[model samples]
Every structure is written in structure tokens, then in C-alpha cells.
Target: MTAVTDEGPGQVRGQVAGQGPGPERGRNPDEGSAPREGLPKDRGRPGRDWDDGLIARRAVSGAAPQEAPAAVPDDDVRPQVEAYVPSGSPLSPRLDALRELVGLSRARLDRTDLAEAGRVLDEAAARQRLSSRHTVVAIAGASGSGKSTLFNTLAGAQISEAGLRRPTTAAPIACSWTDGAAGLLDRLAIPGRLRRRPQQSGTGGDEALQGLVLVDLPDHDSAAAGHREQVDRVLALVDAVVWVVDPEKYADAALHERYLRPLAGHAEVTFVVLNQIDRLPGEAADQVLDDLRRLLDEDGMALGEHGEPGATVLSLSALTGDGVGELRELLGRFVQERTAATRRLSADVDAAAARLRPVYVAEGWPGLGERAREEFADRLAEAVGAAAAGQAAERAWRRNAGRACGTPWLRLWRWYESTRQPRGLDRTVFAAPPEEQLTARQRVEQAVRTVADDAADGLPGPWAQAVREAAVRGAQGLPEALDKLAARAGAEPGRDTDTDSDNGEPAEAAETAEPGGRTGAHRGRAAGRPPRPAWWPAAVLAQVAMTLLQIFGGLWLIGQIIGVLEPGLLTPALVMLAGIIGGPLVEWSCAAAARGPARRYGQEAERRLREAAAGCGRARVLDPVAAELVRYREVRERYVAVTEFSTTRG
Candidate 1:
């Protein structure tokens, strides 16, 4: 009773033999000599000499045939044996999950590739996965290909009308196994009722066959292009395709070139059922299948038990039910393999995710640079100050002028105290030459205009225009502002004295007159009376000559005695003569030298007032604008730095 070891192919064979239920297994002598069960079974079948030719030639050339190593006994624990298998190693669940994910990704990519043509490939893929309980095998082919008859035979009823009609099955007809699984039909949006059949006897041999859903779509080569589109669209989403062709049209270039050739990669999920084989003789059916295999091989689909070369090929008559059971059994096996749906769904998701990648990319806004903001701020400040400087200078000038030309009473007090004598009215009032008289308002207006013009020079564009206009408006307001300031400053005591009569006569009259006579004299002066005569000369001149003679002469003592006797009359006469001779000459000399300098001084005083007013303009208006500009510059710099930091990090 030697224990059977699960090691080499011979050991597997011995185990199978021991487990046999019949004597035929022991009666077959070659059973023990057969290769392992995993090797391809039909490798030595007749007329399959294509693979055999390569092997035979290799053998004839005396090449040493390489053999696979014998499987080691599970009990053998050699040093090189990293691990041992309790039974045959099964696929890891992780590997299956990875494979499913890869398949899903591929399906999604395929859907996306087809999406540019306005088709929702992913939706089709999802619908296919959801309807997996049914085997949605579409029979796609050109017109007159006998697809309707095949559909009727597979359905086991006269479901499709097959006749000499020009076009048939304009829309798809879906047939489901169970009544409730008609939900599958509703999912397809097919408007057909569930026609229940008594459970057919042979349908339940394979449990996987119990829930199969079959769909019959419109012809791909129908005159209506929409029908062809429907065929193509349904083919992409279905679980498996059953390409039904007759012997004549099986080799039809249009069918093979347009659909079958391009869909070679989908061979695992495809089938080619050569229909109306009853029309071909027994030998022709086999010959046609052989030629079809050769064609499918050329198209990269290899035939095994499947109707497709790489897929399954079945030669059957829908009218006679030949080979229909084999088709059903094959379909059942395919349905049992439920992993394709998961694989396809995952692929679709991955592809859709890839397409949405571009939307997630982030962008930032452009910002003003720090240096540019700083430069603009500096220029704005300068422009503001320049416009205001003129007003400031005007204010300064008016202050100096007002102080210089203040009250004559103050001047008189100073003079009287210094010389111990009362000062004349003319000398006190007319002192300091009347302050180059002009109003502070007038000075400010002129200075504002000049300063504004200077500030506005060399500016360009809209900002320049804005700055110029603002400066002009600001300058125009300065005169009024300065007038107000001056009015307020000069509002104190003694302002009337500074503003009174030019020569002090009116003031002297006001001081000397009695109250009742003052009104009469003011009225008389209002009538423009002639000024009084300027005579104090005769007595003073006579005294001055006598005094000079007593101090300096004895030779002219007689002349001195005569001078003393008639001093009053002679002095008066000589004084009148000197006035007559020198009055015009003195007036001319004084007027000639003083005219231009006096005019210039008056102009300078006006100019200074204008400048002070301009400075006031800057202080009241432009300085705020400058402060605002500085704030703007600081904010702009911070904004630029933030944007720059974002860009660098990105």
C-alpha cells in the first residue's frame, strides 16, 4: 500500500487511474503513458500538421530536445527549496484583483478613445457589465447573410421573421431565460414583452446556462446607415459577439475587413458561427471550416473548440438544430467566468479619471511689481509737493510783508523814545515804503498758476492728464484759501492803521479835530479840498545864517550886521529862491533812481505770496494725495510679493 506522492506527471497519472470508477481505465495500457492533463489535448489531431511540421523538422535536425524539470515531491525538503505547495498553487486574490483593475483601465481607455466621435463608450461598457447575467451575443453581418434564421434557431422559437423581405429586424429583439430577468431587457431599453416558455428539458444541464440573455440586433450592412451604427454600437458593449455568416458571405471581404479583422484582439470574447451549412455538402462544410480557420489565422484568431479561430467556430443549421447544444454549452462556460465585467468597469473608471486630469491644474493671476509701485509713489509725492511749494512761499512772503509794514503808532512810539522828540506824522506813516502793496489773495492766485504749470510739465498719458487737471484745480483754490488765512491772521489790533491813508494826513486830521468840527472837516475833505501850503522856511533860514556868521567871520562883520538887521526878510527871500531853484531837480533825481527797483520789489512780494499760497495748496490737498499714494504703493508691494511667493512655491 505505497502512498501516492503528488510529484511528477507519472504520479498524477497513477492517482487518476486509482480513482477511476470503471475497468476501462485499467484496460487502456496507453493511459499510464499519456502526458500531463494541463498540456493542450488536440496538439496531435489529424490535418493539424502545421504545428507538427515545425516540431518534426526540429527532431530530424538532431537538436537536443529540452525538457521541463520533474515536479518535486511535496515531502522533499532540499536546501534550494524555498517553499512547498500543499496542492497545486492557485492564483493569489491580489493578482486577480490587479488583473481585474488592468482590464478595467484598458476598457476605459478604449471608451475614451471612441468618445471623440461623440459616442459614450464608458456608458456602453457600464451597461454591458450591469447586464452580465445575460450573454448578449449580437449576430452582426451584412445584408442577406441568413442572420435572422440563426437568431430564430438559437432562441428555440420562431422569434425572428426570416423571409425574402428587403430588410428584417430593424431593431434589436432580446430574449431572456427567467421572467424576472426581463429586467435585463428593460435595462437594454428594448420594448419587447417577456414571452415565457415551459422550462425546456436540456436547458438545465449546466447551471451557468440558466441565466443567459440573448439579443438579436439589426443587420450591419442595411441600406440605412443608422441600422449599421446600431449594430456597431451594440457590438462594443455586449458580453460576447456571435458573427453569423453563410458559406458564400463568410469570406465576404466587406464583413471580414470592416468588423472581424479589426476586432482580432477581442477573440477571447467572440464567436464565428457559419450558418446554413445545410446548403453546403458534407465535404464542403468541412472544407469551408478549414478555409475559415486559415482566414481567421491570417486575421490573428486561432481556432480551438470555439467558433472563432482563436475563438469558437460552429458549423450548424439553425433549421436543423445541428451543433446548437455545443454552442449552448460553450456559452454556459463563458457565462461561468464572471470576472470580465469587473475588469471592464474598472478600466472605464481609470480612463474617465485620466480625461479629467487637466481640469485640476491650478493657475494664478498676474500682479504689479514692487519697484514699479515705489517709483510711481515717489513721482506722485514730488508732483504734490511741487504744486504746493509755490503756495507755501506765498504765505511766507505775506507774513514778512505784513510784519514790515505794521502800525505807524508802533513806529512813532519807537522814534519818540529814541530821539526824545515826537515824530512827524509823515515820517511815521510813510516809513518802510508802503510794503509793495498787493492783496495776499492776488499773490496766491499768481503763485498757484505758476506752480501748477511747473508741476504739470513733462507728464504723459491718462495719469499725466489726471495729475495736471488735479493740480490746476488745486492751484485755482489756493488764492481763496490764502485770502481766508491772511484775513484771519491780520484780523487782530492795528490792522486799520496798516490799511489807512498813504501820507498820514487823514489820520492827523482825525486826531486833531474837535468832535463837531471833525464831521464838517471830513465832509469838506470829501469835497476834495486842495492840500495845505508847505511853508516853515523863512524864520529857520535867518537864524541859521546869523549863527553861522557869529561862529566863522570878522571880514564880513558889516555884511553880518546888515544880515542880522534884515535876517527875517532876507532869510525868507533866500529860502524861497533855494526852493525855486532846487525843487524840480530833487524831484527828478529821486524819481529816476527809485522807479524800476520799486516795481521789482512789488513784483517780488507778489511772487512770494503766490508761492506761499501754493505751499498751502500742497498742504491742504496734495499732501493727502501723496499719503494715499504711499498707502497704495505699500499694498501693491505686498500683493506682488504674495503672488511671487505663490509662483515660486508652485
Candidate 2:
């Protein structure tokens, strides 16, 4: 049999007893009562009997103990306790280890994880408040809520100097029980002097209230924002809260909507004290308390009497110590309950754990595979090759035309003949005007751009943008690509030879029309002019120099034949001609022969642009997405662990 117990307000404590139906059915011989084997014995002291009764009630209600409490006898009770332990339950140590692992995973994620981890850590810290040994209960309210007055009343003296002046408490003041445990003040970084409380001789021993650390924080509604900030900072780190509100402003929308509502999850560690209750008419106090309770409930606070182990709403006059005894008694009982420390610590840990969870979460992203990268590289290379081929072909055509017909001296004549005068030549053979013709260089550039644009198409959002940018860059590099192509073409200057003017032919009529004379007359006149006797014979002898010219001409012809027949010279010249003229022809032929390869290369270049775009996309866009995913995973893990812990501990 399992016995369950509800300890103060929200807590449930359970105890399991009794074995399953056993062979021994005999009753206890000494007591002569029904067998005690399966019955729960009430072992609590007289005054504490309610706790045991509650445990029995919880057990009867089927709320089994999560783990066997130390007091259960081992002989028969151990097996029953084992049976009651839930299967697949994660022990506290296991959960802690898992949380640590989650923390480590979060650390590896980038900036998004860092921010998320910070938030998770904050939540875990808040949760730890539930289990802290020393409770730093801060009394917070607007000015004239008698917060300082309440602080003094709680401390049993005029510890905080209260006045009508606005923002009277400039800084925080702490009061602690003198006989309480030591080190808590030091842990909180509070100096020993600030730990003083007003000496009080009481109906209840003051020593019972030891371990209580009460703080009088600055007013949250002070005109100075810094005061409010300080109040907020202290509130976050404190173990619990005592929200002091006067009857008139107990339901202040700003206070409830802003502070109270947001902190609804911390209700287990909160108390609402309606201070200055004496100001209300005697009968109205009860009504005001009820209203306050209802408001707190609306804000998700559970309210009851003190020592109820949940949130409580109480009306009191801090000035006159009205209801102060009940408050002291409740606080004393809470102090005596050692689990308060564990609860506060656990709560803080939970909060911090939550903040850290987002840092550990893992998210998936769209990634380009290795095959895609290879494909992109190949495409880019092919695009560049095609551009090179086109440029080479154009260059070859230009060189061949220049060698065959162009010259510096005759260029103007050729231009005039081709343009204005129709020399019985085909007009259709002329090169296009610069405006109409796309240069080899321009063609390459356009091709590259086209390839890039095609590759960029159909990509996802930011990736598409990246692909477009990469394509632009690749296209802009086309001029350099063309220059490489031209270098590889290796077109050299062609040989130039002029026709001889001195042929043994008669002068044309145009030539003979010299300004001086007709051709025959000129010749006869030249013949009549010279007849010097012995000197003329010698001049004729000197004029007959053809023998020397003949000898030199014969030698030059022999040298020409020798050069033409030499294998090295002939082979090189032939090869040069083939490359200059044939290279472009070959490219054009290949462009026709292998159009598939050329188009494929162009497509490949586009693919490369897409890949480079993907890398850039990861850097700019995917990184943030991955980080967010990491955060989400971390949060989910912590949320799971926390809910699990809450269930186990319930």
C-alpha cells in the first residue's frame, strides 16, 4: 500500500508501506489486531500528527513515494518501495548529468547560442531561489506602501528610518536574526553590521526565527529610475518576495500587470502583504484581503495562511504589528523546514538551466554537397574555355585578312576602293561597321555573363542573390580570359614584298605625259647631247656592269633555294602558317564538331557561380539560422528536463 501526503500548500509528500499478498496471513500475536504487515504506523509526534495523517491520505489516494524515504524499515518495506518506484524514471543525478551535456553542446554553437544560453542561465538561477538555505526576502512596493514600516515591523524594531519624504530609503538595508546560522550573510556579500535587528523579547522565542534574512529595498516607483533599477536588480537575485501594498493601491493595474503578472511562475516563493490595513475600516479589512487574494489569483498567485507552503495573502499594520505574530510564526516554521533550502537552491538551478538550454540546441541547414561543388568548378572552367575558343577564332580571322590584303601604304586606297568605288568586287564580303559587329572580346564577355545569369536562376532566396553577385564577378573577368586566348593563338606578323619598278617594258601613256616632252623627243634629245670621243668609250665600259650583278643575283638565288629546302626552316614556316590560319578554322570546326561540350562548359560555369553563391549564402544567412536552431534545441531540452524534474519532485 502507498500512502501520500500534502504538506503545506502546494507540496505533496508520500510514503509507501505493505507488501503484496504474502503467504503469511496471521495477525500480530501480541497486539491481537489485524496484521500490521501492510498497515502504515503513525510515527509522528503528537503536535506533528497532521503531517503523518496527510501522508497516509496521499498514500491512500495512490500517490506513491518516488523513492523510499530513509525511515522505512528495510526487512519487508524495501521490496514494496522498489515496486512503487516508477519505471523509466530519471534520477536526479542522471538529470543533472544530462543538463551538463546540454550545456556543453550549447557552447559549441555560435552567437545565437550564446544569447540563448544567457537567457536559459537566468531562468535556472531564478529556479534556484526555491532551494536556497538562506532566504533574502525583499520587501518591494511604491512609495507610502509602508514598505519600510513593514520591514521594521518584521525586524521587530525601527531598523529602517521611514519618513513622508519621497525616496526616503536611498539604499538597501538588511536585517537578520542574530542567533541564526552564520555564513549566509557572507554568501550574500552582506556586511556583518547590516545584519543587526532590533532587540525584541517576544511571546514566541526570537531564536526560532533564525536564518531569516530580510531586506528593505528601495521603492520601485520612486521618481529616479536608478532607484527602480536597483530594486529590480536586487529582486532578481533574492530568494523570495514580500509585495507590500496599501489598501488603496493594492490592485494598482501597473503593479499587477507589469511586475506581478510576469513573475507569476515564482508564486511558490511569493507573499502579498496588504500593509497599513488599519487605515481601512475594521470590517473592510476582511473584504480588502479577499479582494487582494482574488487579484493575486488572477495574477496566478496561490494564496493561503502562512506555513501553507505556497503563496499567501495577509493584511497587517506594519506600524502596530497587527498580524505580525502569525507572520513570525509562519516564517519560523518555514525556517525549521530544512527542505526550504533545497527547494530554493533547486529553483535557482532550474532557472539557470533554462537560460543555458537554448545555447545547446542543434538546428539543421541546407548544405551543398561535394558533388555540387565539383560540378560548379567544372562548369566555370568550361565557360572560360568557350570564351577562349571564340576569342581565338576571331583573332585568327583578323590576322588572315590583314596578311592577305591590308597594308599601311595601300590601306587608304583599299578603303576607298571598297567603300566608294566598286572595283568589280563583291560588296557583300566587307566587314560589318563597328556598331553592328560584336568584337570577339565582347562576345566572350557576353557569353560569360549569360552563363552566370543562367546559373543563378532558380536558387533559393539569399542563395540566388549570392549567385547573381558571383556571376557578375565572373563575367567581369572575361576580358582577362580573352587576353589569355589571344596569347595562346600566337598569330605572328606576315612577310611583306614590293613589286619591282624597273621592267624592260614601254612606259604607259600616263607615265610618258611628263611636263617636259613626249617619249620619243625626250630620247632623241638625250642622244644629241653627248659626244665626247675617248671619254665616252671609257664611260660605256664602266656602264657595262651586268656581269657583277649577274654573279650576285645567282648567289642570292642559291641561298634562297638552300633556305627553302632546309627541314627546320620549312617545317617551322609551314607550322606557323597552319597555326595562324588553321587555328581559328580548327576552333570554328570544333565549335561545330563539339557544340555539346561547349554548351556543357558554359552551363558548368553557371553552376560554379551558384556554388560560390552558396558559400557566401552560408556565411551571411545560414549561419544565423543554424545558431537559432541550436538555441531552440537547447531550450527544448531544458524545458523537458525541468518539467520532468517538477513531476518527479511533485
Candidate 3:
């Protein structure tokens, strides 16, 4: 039931209800109330010996009782209530920001219990709908704070009983100025018996208080546990709170530490009313009010629209009715401005943002870099046997080319060599492609996992999970795709043979050159085929010239022997020897020249095969992995955006 009247800088008027120093705490406020059966011995303050009948009359007229102590002049106090206009207006923009944040983080929030957030959001919408019609303010305090008295003073009627009872108001009592707030009161769960309208509603003086719904909540520090629970529940849903404190317990740890400190952001809608201030000596009241302001500052509660030190603090004697006019006037302005609900919601958004900061704090989610991606692809290439395939292509090509352009005699032997199966390669393993298949598939899967792990490293849980999912999406079907690609690459190495088959002349010549004899010596003779070297025609023409020389020389020798021509034995014999030596020499030189072409042909075949194999590696393994890297990058960017958006400004 605390209420404040802000006059100017360094000055505030408020009301409270006790007469001694602030109380010493026996337990932590955070522990909540003890069990109902374990109530403290001094359940509430000792009863006042003062006349209750005199207090009630003074409260109705908003004046202090004659016997109460005199209060200090307002200017003599150094400053308790700073003039506070709530900082932000029209909470729609902040609400929209918060709603957008919720939408963006919906997936993450779904994992957590949503009750509190749901309640706050629901309350915000409800408050917005009723914004023009009502501002619900709660009057809450500890035992012996005279909160009920203050509630009656503000309403100008004794709606709530003000007495020495430990927990006088077990349930909330709602006093509405206007008639249209029944629904709002229903939302607050105020019983029909506890709801009341201003006593003299037709008086134009009540116009200032229109749209105001003041609720007197049960004592927060009540002996009964349920009373405190009711206070807490209402505090959470109320648009504004007036915390009532007597001069004695204004600095109660349970009040500041548990409630005020946690709600530091709600300072704009918070009013600190020092009740029973008339019980204190004039100077003592100022000292107590200043102390309460200091404690609130320590609670991190910013007071004014300019972000000052504390909420509006004012002193008043509810029993004496002192400061009641200022309190009513302040509340009138509070209702007329119609921003308490918006301010409360804005504060709510700030609190929620602070609580949720950890989840969206951006760090270590840079994702896979280009160099890492290339390295990953390289690793997969080796695992999938890309390099081995390339080398195999090169070897197969050399074998095919060797048979294609070798010397005629050697080509015949090489063709026969081609028919022989290669040794050492496990044909059994080849027969079961599954074994080879597993190797490539496993390699790819491991690579995918590794890259994903690296990308997710040092990231927050949700972003890291997103990175992992992206990697998985990119990796889907990759193993089978790579297997097909490798097979194609392997098949490419054998394509040269098909191309050779398309040239019918080579096959026919090859079959003709095959050894056709049974005996080993006759096999060599059958294997001898004329070399297809470029110099073969020159060699053959030279042999033809030599044969003609030999034949003519032989004819001349025969003529000499038969005395049918002039005889010259030296010339004819020399001619016969020269022709025989030169013909074989020419043929031998042509065979030597053909060897280089055969080697060069084999090298060309190897180069083509190697290119094909490397191409397969790029297409099958590197490309898919690169695609994954791209996805990782995209997710990383999104994570960064989320973090920045969530943290930088709330």
C-alpha cells in the first residue's frame, strides 16, 4: 500500500505505518514463507494502543490524527522522490521486437517450460486491450504497514479493514473508479465481495481517478503462507505496484532484496509509500525516507524517465490522512497518462531479454572455411581411392598402347601377353564389389562427420546442431553417388579398348599376326609380320634394289660359267654379298625406329586415363563435400545474424 508524490528534485512525500527502526531479518527472503504450521512467534507487530475509531475518520478526510508526531517540511529533505516520467511510451514497438525475437527463437524456446513467458505475453495482450479503459495498481506491503488504511484513504472509504491483525487482508480488494473494469478485476481474480466503486461516483472530483483500479493485496510478509502467495501472484500481473512501508521496516531485506531488486526495471510503475511517517519525529521521517531511497538505488531501480536513482518515494500517515491528497493526485495522473501498463510490459520485455541472453550470445560459429573444405575434399579423394584409380588407369592405358604400336615381332608377342591375366590383383575382391563399396562409402561418411564436427566446434548447442544437420543434408545419398562415379571412372580406363575395336583393321592385323604353328621354331617364323614403321617402304624399296642387283649378278655369273657373256667373277660376287647385307641392315634399322613410337603411344594412353580418373574424383567426392561446405557457410551466417540480433540491443 505504498504510494509516492513526486514534487521536484530531491523531494518526495510517502506514507508508512510503524514506529521503530527497520526490522532485523531472521531468514532469507528468497526462501519464501515458512510452512503454515511453522509461523513465527512474533507473527506480526504488537497491536497499536491508539484508538481505531479516530484513525478511520482521519483516513477518510486525508488528514493526520491530532496526536501523531509532526512531520518535516518537504524542502528540508535532501531528496527522496525524483520526478519520474516513464522513459518509453507506446509499448507497441518494444512488444513487437520481443514478439519477433520469440518467433525467431521459437525452436529453442519450445524445449523450455513456457508458462512464465506465456503468462507475461498473455498479460501484455490483455493489458493492451484494456489500456484505454483501466490501469490496475496494487497496494502491497508487509505486516503492520497500515497498507489497508492507506488503501481506504485513497478510495475515501473503508472498503478494506485496517487493524492490528497479522494478516488483515487475506484476499485482494479491488476499488475501481469506473464501472467498465469488471472484466479486468475478474482477471485479477478479485472476488465479487471484495470489489467496490468509489463511494461518491457522481462527484466531478472523482473524474481525475477514472480508469483506475486500485487493489489492496494481502500482506507480503504475512504469518499465513497463503497471504504472501496471493501478494506475489498479484504483483506479477499488476500494471503498477505501491509498496507500503512503515518508518521501522522500510529497509526490510525481504522487501528490497527479494521483490524490488528483481523488479528494478519496473521502477517507472513502482511507487514507494512510507506509511505511518507521522509516527516519526520531523527530522527522523526525512532520514528514513532518504535511507529508503538509497536502498532502492542499491537495488538498481532507476527512478525517473531520465534513468535516475529510485522510484517516486513519498511519506504519509494513513491513519492521520496526511499526504493522502498528494497520493491521490499522483495516482490520478498515473491513471490519466495510461502508460503504466505499457511501462510494466516494457520492463517485462527487458527482464525477459536479460534472462534469454545466454542462448543467443554469438561466438565460435564461423563455420567451415574454404581451405578446410578443400582439405576435406582432398582427404575424401584419397579415401575413395581416386589416386589409386588414376594410377590404375595409367597402367591399363600403357598396356593397351604397348600392344597397339610395338614392333611387328614384339607386337605379336605383346598381343599374346595381353591375353594372359594380370597377377596379384584379387579377382575375388573385385567379384564382391561390396567390400570395395564399403571402403568408399565409409570413407565418405567419416569425412562428412569430421567436417561437420569441425564446423560445429566451439559453437553454442543450437547453432552447432544446425551445422550438423546441414552437413547431414549435404551428405545424404553421397556414398552411393560416389560409388557410381568411381565405377564410371574405372570403366573409363577400359574405353580405349572399345575405341581400338571400332578400328577393324587393327583387330584383323592382330589376329593375322598370332602364331599359327605348333613347333616353337615355326612359331617364331609365323610370328614374324612386316613392321608398319614409317621407314618400312624405304627399307622395302632398298631390299628390292638389292635383290635385282643380286639376280642380275647371278645371271652374269651363270653366263660367264656357260661362256655366253664376258666373265667377271669379282664384280658379280661382290654385288651378291653387298645386296644381301644392305637389305637386312635396312630392315633392322626400321625396326629400331618403331620402338620409340610404341613407347610414346603408351605414355599418351596413360595421360588420358589419369585425366579421366582425376575428373571422376572431383565429380564424385570433392563436389558433394563442397556442397556441404556451402551449406555450412549458410547456416553459420544465419547463426551469426541470430546472435547479433538477439544480443546487441535486446
- Give me the candidate number with maximum TM-score: 3
The clash numbers for all candidates, in the given order, read: 34, 48, 25
Global lDDT scores for all candidate models: 0.42, 0.45, 0.56
For residues 62-105, could you state the per-residue lDDT of candidate 1 as single tens digits? 32322322222111111221111112222122223323333433
Question: Model 1 clash tally?
Answer: 34
TM-score (all chains, Cα) for each model? 0.35, 0.42, 0.62
TM-score rank order: 3, 2, 1
**Positional deviation of residue 153's Cα in model 1 after best superposition, in angstroms:** 1.8
The candidate that wins on lDDT is 3
lDDT string for model 2 (443-493, tens) is: 444444444344433433333344445545545544343333322322211
Q: What is the Cα-based lDDT of residue 431 in candidate 3?
A: 25
What's the TM for model 2? 0.42
| Tens digits of per-residue lDDT for model 3, 1-650 | 11111121111111123311123243324222322222122112233222222222112233443232112111111112211223343344455555555555565445352333444566677655553557889999877778888887777767777664456787998887766666667667777767776565546457888878899988776766666656766777788999898654565665665577767777778898998766665476676677677777777886653545236788887877789889888888888987677666666655655555545544654556776666666656555444433333333333333333233444455445544635422111212234545665666678778777776676656656766776677677765555455444434423322112312212222221211111111111112222244555665576577667777878878988999988779998888777666655655664455556544433443344334433544454445545544544443343343333331121
In candidate 1, position 129 carries an lDDT of 34
Question: Which regions of candidate 2 are displaced past 4 Å?
Answer: 1-102, 105-133, 179-183, 186-193, 201-204, 304-309, 348-639, 647-650
List residue ranges in candidate 3 displaced over 4 A. Answer: 1-90, 93-113, 199-202, 279-287, 305-310, 364-372, 394-405, 408-442, 457-459, 469-477, 489-650
